[model samples]
Target: MYAGTAKFPVRKGKNYLLRIVNAAVYNHLFFMVASHNLTVVAVDTSYTKPYITDILVLSSGQIADVLLTANQAKAKYYMAAKVYTTHSEANIDNTTTTAILSYVGSKSSTTPILPEYNDTATVTNFREASDVAILQAYHFHIDDVYTTDFPSNPPIEYNYNGDVDKTLWVPISGTRVKVNEYNATVQVVFEGTNIFQADKPSNAYSRL
Candidate 1:
């Protein structure tokens, strides 16, 4: 709900860093500005090349930064942040909303207004803006750094028949436990395996 003009003055043409964070418990946020395109500069504390985009998709506990440039004259543009999810029982009645991004020293002092929540065109535009081109470009750069100089010998060796013989079997299970501190029932699940020796060599081969 922190919507308004930035405290600092925004200069036109110059790239400004926009640090975005999603604090919602379950919803993923898509941020966009009306008519303007954003250049994603970084994500998850990693720097990336500037790539043009409109929307930034952010899940809870994720952070991203984009370079916003004022290509046009001073004017108000709707800064919107919408939540998207695939949960069937999701409650979206109170999700999508817009904020104002006012340019400094512009002739128009009026704040930018966003389209209605149900506006189809607005939704489409946001979806189109969520491209990951910049991220892909960054990944390409990383790949170039690690020249493919694989070792001649393979890392692991396997034998069809080995002398050492110990075949184990493991089972997984879960149970509920009572906690006096919380005064509630807690479910505990054991991960991995419950080991047991194989009855026969053929049984071990069959399990494998």
Candidate 2:
């Protein structure tokens, strides 16, 4: 897990780009900057209209870009990224806490204290509803509006002549048993068209 502070001089009223990448093997990441609202500008290499929020969730192999404005200059703030897990099994190993990013020197060089993991209940509650809404809107846009421009052409030609070879078939079988006694085996019939096609007019046919 990568976690450290970044120090950069900023002018008031100007927007700066903040890029976040979730490189964990199994955990998702949640990001927030202390006392500053993050305006998300892009996700997964796609541009989006900026949306202001306090927290952003990033899943594994995902990237997010946000525009952070230093509305006030020469101030210190903590930038935090924490891991999230989704497993429910008892044997699963969950990360206690991991930091991914932070902000360094400003007018002050001291680190801002962060809340304990157990103290983040309100943050989790707020993020849950926002995540659901964003995902639903994304799915609706992709399924209904974004799918209208796909090409309608068929993929393969149907006029090629081919040679015939032996056909192979497999039968299906099943059995039903009494609750506390022996079971009777039953055989079922299975039928389908099996074709073998020659390779490059030189080799023997291959079964499919």
Candidate 3:
């Protein structure tokens, strides 16, 4: 709810390389600069074809490298970021954080318009339109600390929307890892485990 105090000074007709990192542990972020478009060139140290958009979404711990062109009018505009949550009832801090994008020798400013907190359609379209880079190698130091025994499918399969089971209340704990080969395709499905006492509704979302 508080407008942030960060500021980035830019000159007109110049392109700035911006490296944005999402440090949140559980929330995906939607980032945008008022009246400006961002051209993304890389993600997570992997280079991709240039994808341009007005809004960018980054998952938890993800990184994006974008080019910001100071092509708008010579005035101050707010660069804002907000949480993009999938579940409507999920407890999250629904607040917007902002920074100032000031043009050289300008004083007037305006706030940027942002999407709703639960705008899943925009997030889905943004992810699907971009060509993401595939990681080939992982340099990790904890190879022995975790076992590569993560299961591909759930052990128990039931109607996720309907029944309540006592056995499914507890989750299995392990330090498991899954390794993939080069040029491999991986699909992940997150199952809702909790059963609601009331007739509350729920929603599901994925990056791809």
For each candidate, the alpha-carbon lDDT, in order, equals 0.54, 0.51, 0.78
Residue-wise lDDT of candidate 3 within 1-208, one digit each (tens)? Answer: 3254888899999999999888899999999999999988888988665778999989999999999999989999898899998777458888888889889997888787888888999899888656432221234342333456777776567666656687776766554667766666666655455576523345453332
List the candidates' TM-scores in order. Answer: 0.48, 0.46, 0.61
Model 3 residue runs over 4 Å out of place are: 1-4, 132-208
Is 1 or 2 the stronger prediction by lDDT? 1
Which of candidates 2 and 3 reaches a greater TM-score? 3
Question: lDDT per residue, candidate 2, 13-33, as tens digits?
Answer: 677898878887776666676
lDDT per residue for candidate 1 within 1-208, as digits (tens), equals 3345343456677777888788888766667776677777667778654457666667787778887887767866667776665544344744556655666775453333344434556556544444335345356553322223333342343232343223322212222122233444433322222223222223211111
**Could you list the CA RMSD of all candidates, in the order they appear?**
18.4, 17.3, 18.6
Candidate 2: residue 199 lDDT (0-100): 33
Among residues 3 or more apart in sequence or in different chains, the pairs in candidate 1 whose N, CA or C atoms overlap within 3 Å are none
Sort the predicted structures by lDDT, highest score first: 3, 1, 2
Between which residue pairs do clashes occur in model 2? 6-104
Please report, as a residue range, the 10-residue window in candidate 2 with the lowest summed lDDT: 172-181
Residue 169 accuracy (lDDT) in model 1 = 27
